[model samples]
Target: MNSAQLKIHLLCRGIQLDSSVDLDADARPILRTRGGLASGIEGILPGGLSINIPVYESFAADSPFSLVKKEEKYYVFRDEEELSEIVLPPNPKFYSKKTSSGKLMSRIGVMQGTYLGIYPTDICEFWKTDPPSNCRFCSVGLNLGSTEDIDKTDADLLETTLAAMQEEKITFVHFNAGYLGGKELEILEHYIELIKKNTPLMVGLQAAPSADYSIYERLKKKGVDHLSFCIELFDEERLKEVCPGKSRTIGRKQYLDTIEACSKIFMRGRVSGEIIAGLEPAEKTIEAIDYFAKMGVVSTVCIFRPLIGTQYENLPSPKPEDMIPIFQHLYRTTLYNRIPLGMAPNIKVSIVMLAEEGRGLIEKKGFRLRLCEMRNSFIKFFISLYFKIRIRYGKIRLGL
Candidate 1:
């Protein structure tokens, strides 16, 4: 199977690792902090397709796929049959390094694919309410303070970011905090500025939307390269049911409005609307994608993984066949809209299927798709050049 297809299948049906596969010795640890959505074995499929395969989820126990090491090389197997060879992203020694504040760098920030992901604030307030109103599929509450530090100082964030950039040669530093009252953006701004001020690495923030649209503009000025608004469900009622805190506090209209506002502020692909596919109907998910596409906002579609301790732990993961259409639509819409995907250099996000990666799911691509790719190639060149200039000059903001 192709790399993207393998990525989709592995995401839908979690994979089991053979006992011989020592992740600690050979791979990046399953650092399951930051929204608790991911806790999986990470591997890079051929052609640079990096993925986080679910390994610890209950569904993974019976996965048809398994990772086995043979002759010191790792390969995924189907039962006893070898399927494909894979390599684990190295467990970087920087993870063991400590920030200036004595906090372990791994606890402060961990690599999610090629970028350093940091949840530099307290746990989402949704998980701390009287009865707990967290997202049904989120494990951030259980994950924070257990695998990573709960509250990371600005120094910790800067330290971890610099270490990852220096050692991993990372291109971006992503900061995602769970809901923090209405102050999520306000709280994130400090770290965003800190990172921008010190390093050449690009910054992306995924937080509960700010009540004020202007906060995004200020953040862009401060140096947020990208912004992701998790409007998890498109269907209003499903959103209410699945993300009670988001629906009540931020509201469905507000999320879309914020996304719309940012689209005008940032470049086409730089603004993303993240939606969890399995929670809402596939049709709704498509509508959500189209909505974002029309506004020049790329959709960051995350497959609904039934995280272990979340409220939806017992839920079944979506089948790969069922999700195929959703992703196929993802590639077509993004390409047709002329929104560039995979333009940023060395960014391979494993948590969800990227718009560009959806190319593998589509059975056919006509000249139209080819033309878009060609146009995107020029854009990618310019983007790479821009990043080079930014890294050298430091503190250059997107003219958007």
Candidate 2:
């Protein structure tokens, strides 16, 4: 089916299918969505957007679309009619490797499309706060110690990162940690420095805004190519209600200020502020997109999934019809401001809304989208060229 419809279905009701770990139908060593909600695996849609659909015990048994494996290949079927061929990203070659300390390489990181994703720390301080202020929609607290080691070493990160680069040809790595305050930044920097020293992958950090803004400068010095502050909601009151710990500590003003400041340091598409759409008024989300675009930062939006076991698990996801306009607004705002649609093929991750908009830019070819694409391509080309030169010549040697 169409990109919008497919994305909406995946966001609202994950597909009801299952993959065997031992079979090619199973795309293992892949990123799990929404803190391992026992749904679908992350994969590339036929149109080239990264998506994770429901496959195991999904709520949408009645959904017209179902994933089926026929002769080792996976296909999306609509009532016994094939809709599209699906590509399950293969298990990375690095998954079999072990570090010097004998840690499984796959345990250190997982591939989300082409980007190697590492969760530096799963423990969030907010879980232990006197008032229990973790974000209502987040599952980081529930996942602590259950999925990954609470503390990982730099050696583990460095070895795992280089293996991904060498074996899987990954050019980017994203490090995520729940709120550990300054300690979180330290964990990220530790890995960033190690990975930059050992491999050529472009690094991205997802963490809370540091209390000291100067941490941004330090991270840049350590070779963090990109940064994201996940301010999940935009409206001041709703943000406080939904993300009590984040709003209490960083707040909307501080989040925006940090995003703006990091945008100045990283410039344009390199800095991103994550907004969870369908949580607040769509207009507020639109307003947040506008604000991020004007400052030349990527406004990465994820459709609100009421992930199981979280405080808001019972709340329903927003209607797919409602999210269509929000995605359209995001497209227009980012295009008008001349920011890139995504970080490019390898560096981008599978967030549904961004993928839908990227699909629109490719398929729709409307005047505004075409112009935005031209601008986006122009910028992306230069960025790619700059990195190419730096990799070969030891620095950017061009005068332009």
Candidate 3:
């Protein structure tokens, strides 16, 4: 297989064999068995490509690939043949330190590619409710009392963020929390302001869409550069079944409206709706991508891997081949709508497919792919001109 194709295959299939850990290597402790299974080895390849693949436990031992270390260098091998030289992302210097509140810096925030991911809240409120509502595929609810700490103060977050920026050169911060209410937004706003005021890093926040539209404005004012709502399903019935709390509270229309409204406020390419690839049918997933793309919202696809502790733990992961068409559809739709892939540079992370990889696959096979690239170029140029004019003249007030 070609290199791009092989990497995509491995990402979807997951690495089979594992690598030994060296605590003395001065790398970030690879977190295993956490909320999203965000802990794993960061694999760097040719063409500046990188991915955060799971190497913990079964994910390492059950897949078709392996990451082996020899002579202090990491390489990815498939069926005993080396594909490319790789590097495990370095552990941030701040991770070894402690926040002012005595919280371990690593506990406060974890690195996801170029972005520092901070989960401010440990558990989803829906899971805490008597009826106990949560996304069936989510592991956050399962991790609440065990792996995650419930109380992470704003001060702890700020101190950790500052250290990450200074030591790791991370320019982006993604603030995530479970299904908390306005209180979560308030907390996020406070942290956003603190980080914006103190450092040059841009910040992003992902949470349930609030019923109040004004909260979006407040968030933008707080200097949140990008915003996201994790509406994991697109099919009406499936959404209700998969995300009971969201369905019962806001309903599908409100969720869609919230995303559209956020896009209006955040502008095209700045807002995203996260949808898992495996939970629903491929057609519905493609439809969601089209729907979001038309609204100028980027679709962040999280390939469904059944984390061990979640409700769907027994469900098999979608085959790597199954994702090819889904990703192709996403790439074509986003290009048609002129929305850029990925949040920013150096920010490729595990949960979503990198836009570059998708574009590479599309470009490698010319035909309609060539047409898509031409259209993408035209759309990109016009969009760039629009933004430049908007900024240069300051003709309109964005309140940002």
Candidate 4:
């Protein structure tokens, strides 16, 4: 294969391999391939490549990697190959600690691997009325059903989140609750209030769009460092089909409008939207990313991974090769525009690299000076154009 075809093949291979195991030995090849390196390429690199892998890996684990528990051992496998095996992270010290009110800390919330995740409420009116209204990619109902308790109070969540931060050295806190239908705004406010009263750490919240701007202002005041209101799709018709619940509840135009309003309020870098790559037309996603970039909202493009018990379980996921160009373009645009790094706190290294290159242009003299200035001013614009042409000719490539 030529370099272009080779690049595509490598990306495809990266996407095809599932790397959800905890051990580095099992995940390295998938990481190398995703980074556009030869599968066996050995070396250390810079920047925040490790962070992006988790979101995609989370999706991959649900679809491809199967976890089996036999007797005392937990094993992760892909088909017949036993990739890696290990015991789960020890329950944190805080799990055994409880609030003065007597709620179990673990039941309120817990640290999963590296993330501080909380499901304060497991009931969504959307799920109750019509399951299809839910995002096609989400397994919220399945997760809720498998777990015993249905609701966790705001006070309990606050206590647990605070304990995790203080005792576990946790840096980020992520919380998502079930959609409350007519009570969406009110319940969200309760969560924001509780989190603010309890912790000073960076916090993220995900919920269906709300009708009131005041609630958003309250959340911002409550110390919400980042916000993700996922549209899930750029195409209107696709939204109707893939997220019927969200579409009917929030409406397509309202969702986009809310994102626009959020960009204005949260300002660039603090605001973000999620786009499921495999579900929508690639061109539509490109358009959406560019549109969001101009609006100062970071677009997080995640590959579609069919969840085990979801409605789409029997459907196939988009091949990794097809997702490479899109991911590359998205990352390049994000870097060039200086989008705030959101959850990936480690992305500062890459931003510093781009900033230094921009500064280098300003220091050059004569024709070089003018050329560098032009490059510096339109870094994102140029990168977008470059990727557009490269992808059109099937030459797009990424080095992680």
- The most accurate candidate by TM-score is 1
TM-score of 1: 0.96
TM-score of 3: 0.86
Pairs that clash in candidate 2: 15-54, 17-55
Q: CA lDDT, every prediction?
A: 0.85, 0.70, 0.71, 0.54
Off by over 4 Å in 3: 18-27, 32-37, 57-60, 363-400
Candidate structures ordered by lDDT, highest first: 1, 3, 2, 4
Q: Write the per-residue lDDT of candidate 2 for residues 1-400, one digit (tens) a residue.
A: 5755676666666655634223343676433433323234666766676676644332465466667787877777777787777777777777778888887777677776667878877577788898789888777666546544555678888778767766666678888877787578876777788778766557888888875778889888888888888888889999989988888877788888888888888767778889888889889988888888889887878787766677887776677677777777777777778776554445545544563253453345678777777877777787777766554442122111
lDDT of 1 at 275: 91
Model 1's number of clashes is: 0
Runs in model 4 with CA error above 4 Å?
1-106, 110-113, 130-132, 342-400
TM agreement with the true structure for every prediction: 0.96, 0.88, 0.86, 0.65
Model 2: CA > 4 A from native: 18-25, 29-39, 56-58, 343-345, 359-366, 385-400
The prediction achieving the highest lDDT against the true structure is 1
Q: On lDDT, who's better, 3 or 4?
A: 3
TM-score of 4: 0.65
Give the runs in model 1 whose Cα sits over 4 Å from its true position: 392-400
Tens-place lDDT digits, model 3, residues 116-177: 88777657777777777777777777654454456788788878886776666666788887
- On residues 124-149, what C-alpha lDDT tens digit does candidate 4 reach at each position? 66667732466665666655534323
